[model samples]
Target: MTSTEQAVETFDSLDPTTDEVVGTYPVHGPDAVAAAVGRARGAAEWWASLGFAGRAERLRRWKGVIVRRMAELCDVVSAETGKPKGDAQLEVVLAVEHIEWAARNARKVLGPKRRPSGLLLANQAATVEYQPLGVVGVIGPWNYPVFTPLGSVAYALAAGNAVVFKPSEYTPGVGAWLVRAFEEVVPERPVLQLVTGFGATGAALVRSDVDKIAFTGSAATGKKIMAAAAERLTPVVIEAGGKDPLLVDADADLDAAVDAAVWGAFSNAGQTCVGVERVYVHTAVYDEFVAKLTERARQVRPGEHYGPMTMRSQLDVVRRHIADALARGGRALVGGADAVGERYVRPTVLVDVPEDSAAVREETFGPTITVTRVSDMDEAVEKANDSTYGLGSTVFSRRRGMELARRLRTGMTAINAPLSFAGVAALPFGGVGESGFGRIHGPEGLREFARPKAITRQRYRMPLVMTTFARTPKTDELVRRLVTVLHGRR
Candidate 1:
């Protein structure tokens, strides 16, 4: 096929329900991605030369553009991903907040600071400062298209780096809208660039000469990105998949637990990386908790509550998870195989699913949750931390919420709430193990895009010289005597 025909024949973003093509985007290849990165390198210099104050002003102007044109951006998101306009608006608003915070706080968080050189280097005055990487390549997820990508993009820009963003194939138009808005604010250079395609395009971006890469996607894909980055020794920040859990204690507020579970499990059709996928309830209130969850689940009707699954291929995965749970002697009290609709999966709540089942262990990125009864808080913590993924988690308890939250080996935990850690812009957002590494959203986010530079200046020459072409036995003996005097067996 001709290049034009080949490009046209590539997959198009479709309306999930009607299966009609909603938009056509170029399936960017290696050449296109390389060219974009090349342009971004030049942009980085211009952006960095603006200094912190100038960049902050430009960022505020960009924020105004996004706030004023929120509806237009949401419309593009809705058309491309089939998510509700309200949900799209919510993501965009959070994204704008992040952009504003990054712009305002980057200098303070990343500016130079003094540090003690310790007695070993007593004659030196040590200092540390964060320097921006030249260019950053961000591969974002379709879910929360704006918020997730901007979590990286905004911080990178604030740190004085140019960004080349590759939004998910399912939400390329949303990515385009953001890039266009940013260009208007910094029209002197291509400070923000966009490339749209599938996995191949993403692979191209990872292998490019960008100084750093920020990826938000499945853990499986995160591994691939990390491995590819290793080729160029490129630093990366990965916000991968999560099988997050919400624990309930015997003395917990049943109403709060139920509310958190409902919203955490079913919101955005359960496509969130930090969404609750497992619930470990204290056996004392297991039955009561399950009943409350079921009632709340019923109240959340799929169509009015959320839109269709953005990726059509995810339908089979959702169906398989439910079927596997049932075949393994699990019961779906609220929704079963029949709940898997053509485009949207109705909220499914399963009980008695084996802990080893895919529905429990794997990331079933659908509107399905598995609830299990645990003997006590100990068992709850163990099961919650047993997963390969350790992103964010939630705990609902009156007396032991903080203790239990600390025990779980995840990055961040919300007490009496679901995914609240993400809403708090001051806290860091990331995970350990399979959930991925690196953080975003706060001071940690600002430093991720920067490299630490250590500076030391000699205040004066010490009597005991350590780094000159001259050495004396008396000086060595004095140094040993001083060490013994300070830290000897007292």
Candidate 2:
């Protein structure tokens, strides 16, 4: 059967709040995915052939199209993710800004650069440049559909690679619309394509003959994707989940810290990978801080401030964590077990939770946060750095904010601000340890999708060459003397 006919299976993307069908898409299998990659190979070469200036022009135009139809795209994002219109617009705006930044900075970041030849190799000239790795397979997450995936897609394209994206099954319509937007700007080739389905489809794309793979999801799924890509030894970038923390020192601005924590923990219903899941407050102001936080959280509603949990499976996890914490003697200062409703989860804040409890140790991915009391900023840093996840962190301190932020063992940190690193296009986004390796933003992101090429040219022959078989004993003696003169001083 032809590739088109082989995709007989189909699925519907549903609204999380009402279970309404938003859009239906074909469940593309191995054959369909491979066909898309094969087509992308040629497109990648054609795209690369368009030098830096040419590609940047087209990318800016794509950004224009997205900007012009921002409302329509935001509607699609809101429908699929069940997020508020404002939240959807925020993510889309960030995505477009990244696209524009990547397009404009590619030449300066990836272009050829001169490398100095040492005194010993003065006869040689060296230069370095980054080249694209052709086709890339991007397996995106559903939480921040447009923004997360585009973190890789935009950089990969800027580095001159064609992309074949497999968006999460829950948000296929959003993926389809992104592909459509790209096609409208550059109608000549299939430079960017979409494949939608379940886990099997994602696996098929990973197994396909793609140059590289970029994924954003849980650590378990990232491991599976890594193992599959290992069969081909293909390069991969995995952006796994994070159980990030927010630290509040005794000298912190109590009001500002409370506000940042409320927004960081409850925004997006606490589905963000880098969202503040844990807050370590100094004992001096712990009670007062908790009171302020509780008051702020109570004012935030599910459907009004945020939206329902996009993934239904996360509801049970949130409920279990709350029950476990409560059973373990931790108290709920704001919402409790009943906060987890059928579709929406009210902002839940727990206090006096032990570090060993599941609610504090695991990723709840819901509208719940744990507040722990620390003796000092030192203890706060110690407890915050104890997580296997080192993705992002927030520090709220008037005097020691910058110092504490630098001490946190995370990829990025924000001081006196919430989720500030994520909004900055210049910062590198990724984590060490279990949070996953490889970066996906800033100049590091562009280099992640491309390979560095080092070139060397011989300027002229040396008067006293040591590499030739015809070298005399005098030449060796002179070289030894020069080495002694250059290194003996050290």
Q: Highest TM-score, which number?
A: 2
lDDT of each: 0.91, 0.93
| Ten contiguous residues with the weakest lDDT in model 2 | 1-10
Residue pairs of candidate 2 with colliding backbone atoms: none
* Model 2 TM-score (2 dp): 0.98
RMSD of 1: 2.0
lDDT (tens digit, per residue) of candidate 2 on 1-490 = 8766633789999999789999999999999999999999989999999988889999999999889999999999899888999999999999998998899999999999999988888999999999999999999999999999999999999999999999999999999999999999889999999999999999999999999999999999999999999999988998998889999989889899889988888888889999999999999999999999999999999999999999999999999999999999999988998999999999999988889998988888888999999999999999999988889999998899889999999988999999899988877899988789999989999999999999999989989898899999999999999999999786
Off by over 4 Å in 1: 1-11
In terms of lDDT, the best-performing candidate is 2
